[model samples]
Target: MEEAHSSRYSIHPGSTKMYRDLREVYWWNSIKKGIDEFVAKCPNCQQVKVKHQRLGGMTQNIELPKWKWEMINMDFITEFPRS
Candidate 1:
């Protein structure tokens, strides 16, 4: 995003084809990079005025468990008698 955004200010704006060529070289047809997505969705690129979005309620993410379910499953099997 920084490169794309900076390109906007660079007076070139992907004019040199470096970004596009590099995309074709490394990404090899996968078109979902965050920077490309950002540039594609840029209001400036679309020539549309940016609208302010209202803040939405934030949702907290659940904490990650320290171990995998497979490990816990083995423990559960050993610790519990047959039901």
Candidate 2:
């Protein structure tokens, strides 16, 4: 369990992926629950996991230019080495 959870075998995978990995070579009742508990308590996993609900930062709106080409921004639509 330690090996799968934090040793070289692990990359701090989420509980679901950990469950799947364990399922391939091991089996026991409450295995999923155990993995969930382990992952929830894992400091490294908590730190590395993405926070889906947290906003990154405050957003500011861009002021529109009153005249055309006043704030011109261009992009190359064609592929590189254009003919």
Q: Please give the clash total of every predicted structure, in order.
A: 0, 0
CA RMSD for every model?
15.2, 7.6
Cα miss at 62, model 2 (Å)? 17
lDDT of 2: 0.84
lDDT of 1 by residue, 10-83 (tens): 53254234466556555544444645565666555555423454556798896676777633323343566779
Candidate 1, residue 55: CA error in Å?
38
User: What shift in Å separates residue 68 of candidate 2 from its native position after superposition?
Assistant: 28
In terms of TM-score, which candidate is strongest? 2
- Tens-digit lDDT track for model 2 on 1-83? 76788877677778998899999999999999999998899888887767834767998898999999889788877666946
Give the C-alpha miss distance for residue 73 in model 2, angstroms: 21
lDDT of 1: 0.52
